[model samples]
Target: MKRTWIKKSLLVILLVGILFVLAGTVYLKMNTYAPSEAALAVAKTGKSEDQILFFEGEQGKPAIIFYQGALVEKESYSLWAQEVAKAGYPVYLVATPLNLPVLQQNAAEAIIAEHQLTAVVMGGHSLGGVMSSRFVSSHLDHAIKGVFFLASYPDEKGSLENFSGSVLSITGDRDGVLNQEAYQEAQRFLPDQTVYEVIAGGNHAGFGSYGEQKGDQSATITNEEQQTQISQLLIRWLENLE
Candidate 1:
């Protein structure tokens, strides 16, 4: 009986050791399987590498998922995302590899599941913001923390209804590319709660990482200043919300 007891104890110890090894191997494998290629392929639906950029942060603040403008790539938004991460908020870029409309929604749901986020605040640059706004309006029951837009229109893609969520719109005062007509039109949807900020000398591409590629030739603010101001504004707004 004593020998049998010893054998069972050894067997249990061996099983536990094997389980630990298996768990460690799975973790290592998952860490090695990055989705850069899958993300790039999704970006090709309209543009490559336009969907998501991941950044490490303080892990308590809600994740900030950025959706880029129609023609911009995901890498172009990394500068702003990195700045947000530095401020202690995790950030991810939302892409549209399969399709902009579908992928953005899918990305949000998938990220929420992966991170176990009960309430995530979503935003984007230009059309990306538009997409996020539309999404949050419909998914408000999911406990979205807030919604923001960088040089993005407020209305839905095909309709006149205002986007759902705590809307924030930022644009450069000197940005001729972001038509004021559209801005005003979008405002009609959010009567009192929307926060619209216009940075002096900023441009339509203020949220992007690169400025020379846009070829507007009229921007008054340096890219660094624009990026900083944008990041600060986002952080302030995020800190104030419920």
Candidate 2:
């Protein structure tokens, strides 16, 4: 009877593992947003290959490296990067492994090194933002000047409470995926000069090109409107870093 029970337990574990794999596959397929013409167009402004969208600006100028949110295609945040690049600095929309930023924590390092970006700022949307904060904190010796978050905040695991550089935190008022308690608490971890902006009537998915995200409130603004607002905000903040 003991042997029989052991076999049954193993079988149950196998079934559960298979179920989890299937769920993950489905989730990834459903969430990966395709790059649009506008996004490609922006990429063409510099280079579009190797899963890295580059909007080239003045050489040696500071660059902004962006991380992709969980299960989100890297191109989803191209709109913001494009706008920043137009403002002067090259913007890199880093493609993380398995579309998860946490899995590729040091991905930004390679981009910054290979591109010869002297001064850099890191940013992202949602989980991307959280991971970017973690990267900057761990690599404090690197020349990263600051961090930006869209519809996201750093948790204790990636807290920036003692970070000395500039930080920008932008969120949509209607963001349902963002934890209200955590975001409010994150203020304590950021520097006093952190720039926080709340986009009126915006939602979590508004920061990316992906379709409506599950558990997120519907946005009162169109995707273009929301993205444009974020773009302008990023432009102003990054330019100030000059």
**185: Cα error in model 2, Å:** 1.7
Q: Pick the candidate with the highest lDDT.
A: 2
Error of 1 at 60 (Å): 2.4
lDDT of 2: 0.83
lDDT string, candidate 2, 112-189, tens digits: 788777799899888899899888888888988889999888877677877888899999998999999888887776
lDDT of 1 by residue, 1-242 (tens): 99999999999999999999899767644432122333344323322233445776676687776776765656666655666777888777765653244345546777777768875888877767777776676665786777787877657442224435466778877775666797777776553677888888888766675444344446687777887898898888877874
Q: Count the clashes in each prediction.
A: 9, 1
The pairs that clash in candidate 2 are 161-189
lDDT of each: 0.67, 0.83
Q: In terms of TM-score, how similar is model 2 to the real structure?
A: 0.86
Q: In candidate 2, what residue range of length 10 has the lowest lDDT sum?
A: 35-44
Q: What is the Å distance of residue 119 in model 2 from its true position?
A: 0.4
Runs in model 1 lying further than 4 Å from the true structure: 1-51, 98-106, 157-165, 213-217
